[model samples]
Target: MHVQNKKRFYLMVGLLIVVILLVGFSIYMIWSDISSSNAPVQTASNTTNTANADSSQGNRTDITASQAITNPTDLLVLVNKTTSLDENYQPSDLVWVDLPGVRETQLRKEAATALEDLFAAAELKNLSLYCCSGYRSYQTQEELYAENVKTYGQKEADLVSAKPGQSEHQTGLAMDVTAESVNFDLLESFGQTTEGEFIKNNAHLYGFIIRYPEDKTAITGYAYEPWHLRYVGKDVAAEIDKNNLTFEEYLKTS
Candidate 1:
């Protein structure tokens, strides 16, 4: 009887030892799995932060060059010196007749010449283009703003016209072109026309670009104006056109 009791006690001890070993192994495996699951999340967070830092570093590198001026105030001066546009928002008073007999004034001689070259290159075909607006003086801009406010109210007018000195037209680097058939109305439908497409594809060759492209309204501070072209000169315009960038982006890169 004593031998049988001892045997039973030994059997119970063996069973308890086996259960403890199984429980410990299970706990260890669970801990390892949890640790493994967290590794990918940690790696992803590190990668995201690293990518943002690299992008910021690249932007800083672009600005570090002596010739590359990124600040709008400094860039305005650089662009004015580099191009034919008037400095300090002064526009030329000379008005020239364009291809379709539209009398238009340009801010500079270079702007007129560039337009003439572009017009000559255009096939025209059945399409006739007219220059509606070119340069604007401080007074002219104020008058336009007043008129817009009367017609569209203050808020709406502000969107369509710049506040006097802030306008690109005041610098004489920009122009407004339109289809003669449409009476120079700026519209997206014009972009679908062959003449529009031609201008879109070839304007960069003559140192011009569509100032407010459809995709870049947020950056340009204006709605899409297919007719508005800004002259930054051939080299810069070509780069902007080729890279599919806004003047703001081009300014940053410069």
Candidate 2:
């Protein structure tokens, strides 16, 4: 009887040890799971990246976020990534463009007249230039920018598209031009076509300038858009072209 009791006590001790081991393992597993659950999970869409000016573009002006632009109606008003026009701002003199285009668009009366002359001059040279886009509203720009972000991701979209209220098109002075040689699409290769070269050389004669030049992408915060023209009046446009300055640079020194 004594031997049997001792045997039972030993068995109980072993079973208790096993139970304690199992409990400890479960506690450790729970703690590990809790730690993993608390950790951060980074995703492509959630990652934040602040945009910095390209060093090659020269020292970028540190603009206050959502800075108010008071000269929204000025022909040379500056709009960019930092500065923004009012969401409700629309040009009072907006007029439908009579020039050939991919879609119906409008620009300020003065800019519309300038664009007409530019197109007519191109026609004289047998260089068929078509308006791709012009005079975007804040809402339209928002939707367009959202679409771009969905398609290209935020980082890439920022490089190619402007946020709402930050676009120059909102001022009714900017136009995106294209040609049949490139299927009437906005493309960098359009800069190499005959129409592109003609516009680059002579657009200023009609009160426009290649707003974003090939070599000034850094300063402009945009890619080389030879097709994008901004009407800044004949004198300002001529000075900008002659000095080989982007509109941003011209504004700084002027």
lDDT of each: 0.68, 0.84
Cα misplacement distance, residue 8 of candidate 1 (Å) = 99
Q: Residue pairs in steric clash, candidate 1?
A: none
For model 1, residues 1-254, the per-residue Cα lDDT tens digits are 45668878999999999999999999999999999987855448778997676444312323422333333222232232123222344632344535453564664666778888887777455456667788777678778878889999977776666766566776666788877545567677778777788789999999888888987766776777787888767877788899999877776677
TM-score for model 2? 0.73
lDDT of 2 at 24: 100
Which lDDT tens digits does candidate 2 get at residues 1-254? Answer: 35658878999999999999999999999999999999997665533332232211111223322221445766767888878889999988899999889999999998999899988988888888899899999999999999999999998898789999999999999999999999999999999999999999999999898988997767888878888898888888898889998877777676
Candidate 2 positional error at 182, Å: 0.4
lDDT leader: 2
Q: On a 0 to 100 scale, what is the lDDT of residue 17 in model 2? A: 100
Which segments of candidate 1 are over 4 A away from where they belong?
A: 1-89, 92-101, 124-126
For every model shown, what is its TM-score relative to the native structure? 0.62, 0.73
* Cα RMSD (angstroms) for every candidate in the order listed: 17.3, 16.5
